[model samples]
Target chain A: MESPSKTYQPTSTPFDVDAIRRDFPILERKVLGKPLVYLDNAATTQKPSAVIQSITDYYTQINSNVHRGVHHLSEEATNAYEGAREKVRQFLNAGSVEEIIFTKGTTGGINLVASAWGRKHLKAGDEVLVSGMEHHSNIVPWQMICSEKGAHLKVIPINQQGELDMDQYTSLLNERTRLVALVHISNALGSINPVRRMIEMAHRKDIPVLIDGAQAAPHLAIDVRDLDCDFYAFSGHKMYGPTGIGGLFVKKAWLEKMDPYQGGGEMIKSVTFEKTVYHDLPHRFEAGTPNIAGAIGLGAAIDYLRAIGYDSILAYESDLQAYASEKIGSIPGVRLIGTAHDKAGVVSFVVEQVHPLDLGTMLNAAGIAIRTGHHCAQPVMDFYRIPGTARASLGIYNTRAEIDHLAETTRETIKLLS
Target chain B: MNSTKVAENSIQAAQDSIIEDFELLEDWTEKYKYIIELGQVSPGLPEALKTPDIKIKGCQSNVWLHTELKDGKIVFSGDSDAMITKGLINLLINVLSDREPREILEGDLYFIDRIGMKQHLSPTRANGLASMIKQMKIYALAYKTKLENAN
Candidate 1:
């Protein structure tokens, strides 16, 4: 890997963010009659008007099944649906549309691979490597698969600062290692795993890698081709699209080897009384009626992202995150969690004398939205010996002013509680 | 309509119906939804009881409860950011509150099992109810010991 140039500066984004906020009509409204300052982007993002309109437009105009029917509506829906597939291809910069398989979301994608791929390939002595900072979605699926297949699950421990122990991860890789499944970014801690390095290491050992990009896709630029990950999964809702929609990018070679997760109509080529043949690489994985509106919304979300420029969004979010860390972490009794050197726009902290729920309530009263509790990372909480932490995650439309408000409310809360 | 006298008569009748000694109850699934309905009618804790000490750990919302013993009846005050949980606490307090301190100190939480409210709770909520009950019982025991020592 080439070292980042000391003098080199990444290109900065220049978009009218207020105008972008206007694109998301939900931001115009308030929660609990107070102006909603939604900072829970890590949980799910608010959809832009384009994304919302796309869903309405799809159902309003071209609502039909795709890849099978010959009617005009089906044709239009097929084009629009496949068009969204192309958008997803461009969104992740994957090699081909054939590589993108739509699923319910990241959870569905991981489960699909685990049930179809892990179940077939893994044996009693095989091991699946995952990081300590994984969400329950990432961890539980593998654990379930491993337990059923009689395979062992190995965890790559994090340091005190919540960064993965790369040395330990490398040591854990050996002959019995069937796969290395890791999150590209920690949802709870916002720690960016070194995917390129991890992928390369796993490749050398001939073990396939699956990168959980649910957190990363929302906050960063992801090119599965560039990363060379065997499988990458992310949710559209986290990327400003609607819920119940997402995709898994499986390498063509691997998809050919893996069996279909579900057996249904579209996934079949020709069904006979005695025998049935499966469809091609991507189609084989996508069975049943798809989320046509959701796929359209996801495409529009990608457009919204592209219009603002992914690099610029990442840069601006990174800046806001750093500013938030400095301002919020400076408050007395507030200890920041997930202090990885490479982090996304997420700040998680715990106050010395206040439970995260109390902090969340006070923040809610102030009209500032933040996530409280384990954030679906119970093992991480158990590791730290704390119940949970309050998290405020930033998005492309978020501003420094919101961070200031978050800090101010947090400070005021500590004072009040004390 | 003599409603006050009727209410007193009903209270006397309810008292008359009380069981002697603790009785182990069966799985209370038949009454589960009603207990949940009871949770619906449960009121919010007083604003004064919202404090850091009584906060239920691991919940997504803030929940606080304070209990007091006066005239041999336990009284509870509690509140929460979330509505259903507040209602749940209210239901819990309504049953356990106003009970004899000796009964509370006896560590017989079988009525909760009898009611089978834990079945409806998420694992987190169930654990939280356990902790709250645990704290309440501990508080009652401490008070009982103090009363005994004072005598």
Candidate 2:
């Protein structure tokens, strides 16, 4: 919220991005005979060696399912898995371990809320409110359940700068508004919403909120207790961990009330033809043999972040983002999208007369990996009345020199295209 | 070059010509620039023909193709949302347009690989190219049926 990197405050590691880049082996790889400049962290991050090694170690040493087995391997594996959940609990500063439910990814977590919570409570005439800038993962699940329940899906609009129009958001809320689902940060535009304030406003009306922290978790230091959101969802892959693994942090009260999303072995206390009593808390939500290695890898990623200190990450990322934004924006025919006052490590822009796919192809040819499409946030694209914008999203290890190259190559690409 | 010409070998000849043209380009960037130029210069499809029914499914890029059975030869025209894809559409049009339905339906379509276009394409775009070819072949198959029925 404070002006990010206005006056540079030294990180604990003192902004040594080169050393951090070394932590990721993928950064060393060349693409098309040129060194790779990966700026697609918003889609998914490149795994650090610590995270990669953690997965290998889990498979090589302690490769067993957790919770049920009584063997020594099982206990070690269980400890590793649950330890990862505890790490997530600490990462978000949630109330307790009971609130942390591991799922497939951010989409799985949001769908859990939509199916379990929506089917139980939402009535025919209810309204499910979401911001216009949400990824399709956050939007489509609600639309599906809302359609089935005969509930209406309402969108809170954003301005040209991509900030939410707070007055409209307030006016849209009423007795029919059952829940407010919003993205903590826009994947398409890099707009950081004032979610704490939005959460407070929703809580005032007895309406719970779900923060899609898929983008936020990778960049910001998330504190669910501090934000006081009813539910938080994030993907491990976006945070330099493995794919097919993520977490959902539910308020304990909601966790107690919401029905089990899936009927599976681990989620059951006792299975009867008459009635199946569900397992308590996190187990009730986790239904299958979880991604064991992925969870351990996520824990390792958390450890990696902790070692570097999130304060350092925040400071360095802010500085990098500001410098990249200025550099990229200075290019002729490049129009920056989502120039929100409070932004993180994203730069979405459009070049005059060049399609995003062409631009992406051009960038790829030059050995930069950026996302170019609707970015799974088509509503934002529809609002802008464009097909897609080229997006360069940052990670903790990104250097200013790489950004300079990106900008330089982009200029050359535009020249060649024109 | 005639829209309804009765040339049988011209289709494959045109495919070879495209491959030759692409081989003259230095790199993927230059090849793409040529593709974009071809796409830009290619004729636009009528807005009415850009319907859902004519659209090729599973294409990462949106592509529409329309076929006309004229003078016993099938003429195909199409459009695409992305420039690279549009260029691909143009390439397909250049190769198969104004050819007999039977020749087009059974055409080699191997110039893409010969030109190293397949290697240059991203996986999604490669899928789009396949879909484009499939759509063009389907059009040819339809015209083949109509020609046989008339005969």
Q: Candidate 1 on A116-137: residue-level lDDT in tens? A: 8987899998999998999999
Interface root mean square deviation per prediction: 13.7, 2.0
C-alpha local distance difference test of each model? 0.79, 0.87
Give each candidate's fraction of reference contacts reproduced: 0.08, 0.40
Candidate 2: DockQ?
A: 0.40
TM-score of each: 0.78, 0.89
Put down candidate 2 lDDT per residue, B1-151, tens digits, no spaces: 4666535567767887787888888766677788888877888687877999988898866788888888999888889877777888888888888889888887888889998878868788888888889878888888888778889
Across A1-418, the per-residue lDDT of candidate 2 in tens digits comes to: 2211112112335457877777788999988777899999999999888788778777778888888889988888898899899888999999899999998899999999999899998989999999999999999999999999999999999999999999999999899999999999989988999999999999999999999999998888999999999999999999988998999999999987798878898888898899998888889888878888888888877777777777988998999999999999999999998999999979999999777787888778778999988899888999998878899999998888889989997897778667
Best by DockQ: 2
> Which residues of candidate 2, in runs, are more than 4 Å off?
A1-14, B1-13, B24-26, B40-81, B148-151
